[model samples]
Each structure stands twice: as C-alpha cells, then as structure tokens.
Target: MLGEPSYTMNDLFAQLGLDSSDEAIDAFIEENKLSKDEKLVEADVWSEKQCMFLQEEWKKDAAWAIVIDELNVRMHPTA
Candidate 1:
C-alpha cells in the first residue's frame, strides 16, 4: 500500500544526481542536509531533472510521495 517505498533509496538518490551507492548516499545526505528547518523544494543542489522529479513526485503524492517527502526534508535550503 502507501507505506511501501516505491523507489529504492539508491535510485531516489541517483535521480537527484547524488551517488546511488549506500555509503555515498549517506555522505551526500550528511553533506547536504537541511538545518532540520528546511524543505526540498527550497534546496538548490538538485539538477534541473532532479528538481523536476522531486517536484512532480511531490505533486503526485502517491507511491512516490514517501521518498519524495524524505528527500524534501533532507535537502538544504537554497542559499
């Protein structure tokens, strides 16, 4: 159902132009994290495709919603 993750965490990271490897993903998250006070749409690190993917998935808000939300929460705010 809705609780199941649609995209693998790796794939999701790749779509954002981040390394898809687990360790790299972790490091990327660490390096690009929001201040626990920002949203993904506000982040500037995403490539145009990455940004579009995130934005569209956010709009879909279905199976992809969970991972999109996670990405949104972790992305740093645009400088």
Candidate 2:
C-alpha cells in the first residue's frame, strides 16, 4: 500500500503563507525540525537550513536590537 506523501520546502512555504525570505523561512524551520544539510536535499519536511541562515544573518542585522527591546519591555513593564 502507498503511504502519505511528504512535504517539501515549497509546500511548507505555501501552507504557512510565507515567502522564501531568510527571516520567514528560518522561523518556520526552527518551529519545525529540519537541518541545514537536510534542507538542501529533497526532504519530507522543512529543515534547519533556515535557522542556520537566520542565526548568521540576524547577527548582521538590527533584529538583535528588536529582540533586546522586546526582552526589556517584558522584563520591565513599567520601564
């Protein structure tokens, strides 16, 4: 008997209403369980490649500032 079909990165992106951008893709990968190398190949699901790319790209962008600001707000509601 045939089993269920697997999902590719393209398939996932469509389902999540996300583009192949670094940020969106990375978030999805992190939420799911995929690896960088794994993503390169045709897998049954998303891969960590998105996360890895984001980790490096985020370090070079202002995203860290936003994260820090959010954390501060959460920690110091009155501040």
Candidate 3:
C-alpha cells in the first residue's frame, strides 16, 4: 500500500490558486506578514475561495494541514 502524498509550500500555494514558484512564494510570505493577533484564514491577502479552502483544510486537519500550518507560522512572524 502506498502512503498518502506529502505536501509542500509550493503545493499549498498551487492548491490555493496562487503563484507556486519558490521565488513567488518567498515574495508573498515577505509581503504578507501578519500581526500576532491576525488569523491566517481571515487575512486580506486571500480571496474568499482561498480563505474557505484554508479554513476547511485546517478545520479538518487534512493532509494539507501541515503545509497550511507552516504557512500560518511564516505569515505570523510575531506569533
């Protein structure tokens, strides 16, 4: 039997329908730092669909959760 596919930041970005290139991901992270009180799913940087996808995946603790949590941490440097 095969294990479930692992995900990365690039895959998460692509799933979110955003630019998935390393440089683009880096640029996006640098540009979108969130304050400690800010929430990743509620960030203005995402479209409504993007927000829903993130929130749903996170709530479900799906396979994408690891990458999503990674993104949340990167975005909230103050946290």
What does the lDDT come to for candidate 3?
0.93
Q: Which stretches of candidate 2 lie over 4 Å from their true place?
A: 1-3, 21-24, 27-79
Shift of residue 58 alpha carbon in model 1, Å: 0.6
User: Judged by lDDT relative to the true structure, which candidate is superior, 1 or 2?
Assistant: 1
Better of 2 and 3 by TM-score: 3
Per-residue C-alpha lDDT of model 3 across residues 1-79, encoded as one tens digit per residue: 1586789999999999999999999999999999999999989999999999999999988889999999999999888
Worst 10 residues of 1 by lDDT: 70-79
Give candidate 2's error at residue 13 in angstroms: 1.6
Model 1 deviation from native, Cα RMSD in Å:
4.0
lDDT of 3 at 44: 94
Which lDDT tens digits does candidate 2 get at residues 1-79? 1563544444434543567565765564455443434422234442467444434534664434344233223333234
TM-score winner among the candidates? 3
Candidate 2: count the clashes. 3
TM-score of each: 0.72, 0.24, 0.94
Which candidate order results from sorting by TM-score in descending order?
Answer: 3, 1, 2
Clashing pairs in 2: 34-47, 34-48, 35-48
Q: How much lDDT does each candidate structure score?
A: 0.72, 0.43, 0.93
